[model samples]
Target: MLTTKLGVLLSGRGVVAGDRVRDALADAGLTMRSAFTLTQLAAGPVNQQTLIDLLGVDPSAVVTVLNELEGRGLVSRQRDPADRRRHIVVMTADGTRTLHTVEEVLDKTDDDLFAALTPRERDQLERLLTKVADADSCAEKY
Candidate 1:
């Protein structure tokens, strides 16, 4: 069957897992994209273009996400001092708390999703996935 193909199986599982994680994030009033953005901003402030690069999404898409986060008081954007045209993005205190909450949500979701796998198997899967991801030239775009 087509599902037996490695690529097909991997794609199917990836979609399902991504959906599950997105659902969990939604319950916390965040999108997967927004959560990822918050995680990046948690480290330090970065300009909008940097987010556009890191997210591997269109500049408009990054603006939309930033708009959403700003509306929610989860992030703020101010003009970059070095570049008047660039806007620096930073996570708010609420954003930091929300990021922590989503991290816990993701941890729980991962546990549930991989319950069928043993601890060793889970570790192996992570390593294998990382290896495959690292090998992908497309991944370098992000």
Candidate 2:
């Protein structure tokens, strides 16, 4: 039963279902998935390579996403003052507002996603998921 459930959860339906959540978020103009780039930028100025590592996306893809965000006046990328060889990306005021909107949407999305779970179960799930995320990074270092 456990194996069957795991297999189903790993199937395309599960993937698409998760995509639907992002789609719904994007439909509102927040674009939560790509906004990870903006959110990372919002943290502080980070170079393109840093975004690539943070988002785990291809270099070309990262450039494309940054281009779109820049075109929208949401972000700015410039030659790092201290490191001419690297470009630093930073969020504008608009980007900060948009990131806040995305956070609100994410809060709603999470509530909807975990609607079936009790508060205690939700806490347990968060702990377990954090552990899994940590393990993934640890695996990458090995």
**Winning candidate number (TM-score):** 1
Q: What is the TM-score of each candidate against the true structure?
A: 0.89, 0.79
Clashes of each: 0, 0
Q: Candidate 2 — which residues are off by over 4 angstroms?
A: 2-4, 10-13, 30-32, 137-142
Error of 2 at 1 (Å): 3.1
Per-residue lDDT of model 1, residues 22-119, tens digit only? 89999999987788889889888999888898888788878988999999999999999888998999999999999999999999999999999999
Where does the lowest 10-residue lDDT sum fall in candidate 1? 133-142
For model 1, the stretches where C-alpha displacement exceeds 4 angstroms are 139-142
lDDT of each: 0.90, 0.76
Residue 98 C-alpha lDDT in model 1: 95
Top-scoring candidate (lDDT): 1
